[model samples]
Target: MACLVIHGGAGTIPRASLTPEGHQAARDGLRDALRAGWAVLGQGGLALDAVQAAVVALENHPSFNAGHGAVLNAAGEHELDAAIMDGRDRRAGAVASARYIRNPVLAARRVMEASDCVLVSATGADEFAREQGLDMVEQSYFTTPLRQQHWQRAHEEKAGLLKRERTEAEKHGTVGAVALDDLGNLAAATSTGGYTYKRVGRVGDAPVIGAGTYAANDVVAVSCTGLGELFIRRGTAQDIAARILYRGDDLSSAAAAAIADLTADGAGAGLIAVDAAGAMAMPHNTEGMYRGSVTADGVLSVGIYSDDFAAVETIG
Candidate 1:
């Protein structure tokens, strides 16, 4: 059995706000990620490798907030964060507030493989990436023309609105991947640039293995996207796994329940889960969340809007 899942992000994004081209771009990105994972799984690769490949595809895409086109910080620099987990070994690695590292998730994987530590931060992670000879770039290299325009528009919107503390909820987009490989193992990964105008050194759920990323051979693997603060507060990723392991909930029910709990608490988010059986689920409380999956039966499905959920019956 080989299954893979991906998410663009989860939030209150109105369908009307996305142009047809924007929607197509997101769908294309998801398809690319899914195909990347499928290619690995097709060759009998481990779940961790499949997930890493999938997320790397998203990280390289300009449309998503992960690697190249990530959101800028308060100082107008891109700070990347990512995490990866291998359930079979119960080992994980993460990097937060990192700059200049071209692929944060690969850096995190190196940390997991080379060090005894579970997490590393900013300069330290960048140093590790340098040591490993990963591509390093100036902060300016991360700034995309569309992102710059979005930042300018955000500034204008901020100036007009009376609300001074409007959070990153206003700029909602994240990319994540989860996979169940042929050997019946599960792995998960998540990457993000954090929210727009994020405070310096602000660590979101993306870098926390069990919060933003989790994998368990006994149950499922999960990757989350949404309000980072709320996910940190609720431990969304682990909670979903707990529900599946403790309450005997199916993967889809557990994921849906987790999203429902967040929404009930006024925290918007979305999640992707893949069980050991290659069952998958993606649920969100917003108008749209970019998601796609391949089932154990080799069926492929992808969608961008909330309404697409009804057509993907296997998920829920």
Candidate 2:
């Protein structure tokens, strides 16, 4: 069986805050990502390729908080994070706080195959990207009118210039994909621009293998988003797999428990996961999660808000 699931982010997406146009935009973005991953799986490609291809679609989409449309940091710059994992060998690659790379996930894959290390950061990651001939663009390339507005609003909020409070959607966003291939291999990939107005060098769960991304042939492939601090502390992604592998929990129980664990700790997070048995779970302790999924049946479903999501979107 070949299946893939993906998420744009998880948070309180209030219907009031999302206009019909915005809702449609989010659904369209998810559909685009689904088609991209499905194309790979339809070609009998590996899960690794499917996951990467899916993530790239989100990264390129302006609606998602990744790659080209990433949010800004305190310094008004974009520092992207990404990670990818392969189940067959349990190999992982990641990049943190890199500025120049167009696609941090691609750079991460390069590190996984071309280097001896599993992680890279800062100046070194930039050097690696350049050496690998990864696309380089001026930092402004990541700035969009929408993100610039966010950065300005955050600055105003920090300075007590804006009287309004922040919305849940403004608090978090991330893009990730997980896949199980026809060959029974699993893989996961996650990419993010971190939260709005974060510290310049702040690195979140996206680039942390077990926290935001994990894959294993005997357990599951997982990608998580939200509350990076809590995810890192709890090893969120891996914990879901652990419950399945060690505690005999099914995909549903394990995924729900992982999100429950985070919420009990007074934090919010969400994840999309697929087990070795081809069962999939997308769990979140939030108001809404922008997500989608596809299975061997060739049907695709994408949803934005909780009340509007179809069960078919979660299952197939």
- The best candidate by lDDT is 2
Clash count (model 1, backbone only): 0
Relative to the true structure, candidate 2 reaches a TM of 0.96
After superposing all C-alphas onto the true structure, candidate 2 shows an RMSD in angstroms of 2.0
Candidate 1 local lDDT, 31-125, one digit each (tens): 88878888888788998998899898988887788898888877678889999999898799998989998878899899899988889998998
Give per-model CA RMSD. 3.2, 2.0
Lowest lDDT 10-mer window, candidate 2?
307-316
Candidate 2: segments with Cα more than 4 A from true spot: 311-316
TM-score of 1: 0.92
Q: Which tens-of-lDDT digit does each residue in 238-303 have in candidate 2?
A: 988889988899999999999888999987678999998889898887788889999778778777
